[model samples]
Target: MFFSKQWITGAGLALALLGGTPAWSADPAATTTAAPVAAAAAAAPAAAASAPASLDARVQDLKGDVIRLNRDLLVLEEELLFPASTQVALFVSMDVGKLFELDSVQIKLDDKLVTNYLYTPLEVQALHRGGVQRIYLGNLKAGKHEIVAFFTGKGPHERDYKRGTTIKFDKSTEPKYIELRIKDSQAKLQPEFEVKVWQ
Candidate 1:
């Protein structure tokens, strides 16, 4: 059905050749002329084997486009809400979390608790697979600030553990990025958590 235009064009061309010729008085010549047109018409059925023109396929393509557009809009909204000049973001990552199993994390900015997050099993699994999760996002004025993070989880030997780490960072006019990286220390037989400030 999609080859309607091609078929019409081929048929129209054959009709024009059969009708508009001044020397079509010979039956042999007319047969020779119709042979190539018949061959072209026979090939038109191959269009049925091409890619789909179904409604479901078009709807699926539209859905994929909408998802990408929504992600872009969300990123734009975040930039507007937390402008880069004053934005401060904290992220958590795990590099082979063998010695510690993360349960929750509490962040304190300038001795005041700002954000606390409890990780689900799915989130922990995502981090174990080399995914980084953004735990906190806020704005800070241009000055020196201290960030204290309390990590509570299961330590070595399946013992309950809570460890606190601090980092003093100078907040400039640029956006500040801090990463709480938890990596296994095979040599020391423990997990090491550090606050890394991105320049």
Candidate 2:
């Protein structure tokens, strides 16, 4: 009778405990709350974004430099195909109407006096025949040079004129002809000239 009474008491206690348990245990409300919290936690990493702004700027700058370098290389290749020559031509055209050749015509190449003439009106006429006057510069060195022409006008005074041109000498070439076109004879202003060196 005692053993049977003990077993009945234990069974009754187990039933009572099961009946009085918290409602959340079976309703799943706690689990639902925990699911949303876990989702929010998982999304938190997205909020911490990465910009790398400095790295982006550096990449852009490098890209620009590469483009510029490519253009420069193309130009260099074209120029290399027809590299400059050692020989060049020096040409000058002047107005004979306003300032008739009065006398001595002098020109200097690179500070070295090349031509000096004595004044004579007849010398101008002689130049047409190449019998009296010819501006001659023999086998000049390759590189930059300066040309200064001096002439005496109708007046008894001396006047100075300048024409600056750059000369480039290449690896294996003789001088090609150069030209100097005179501008504004009446004004006697500075003149612009171009020299081409060919190989």
Whose lDDT is greatest here?
1
What are the TM-scores, per candidate, against the unseen true structure?
Answer: 0.69, 0.34
For TM-score, the strongest prediction is 1
The TM-score that candidate 2 achieves is 0.34
Off by over 4 Å in 1: 1-54
Give the C-alpha miss distance for residue 179 in model 2, angstroms: 4.4
- Cα TM-score of candidate 1: 0.69
lDDT of 2 by residue, 2-77 (tens): 5686776677667557753233244477558767888999887665443466668899999999999999998787
Candidate 1, 1-199: lDDT as tens digits: 4667677667667867777433433457767786788888887676554445565688899999999999999999999999988999999999999899999999999999998899999999999999998989999999999999999999999999898899999999999999999989999998888989988
The global C-alpha lDDT for each of the candidates, from Candidate 1 onward, is 0.89, 0.51
RMSD to the native, candidate 2?
19.3
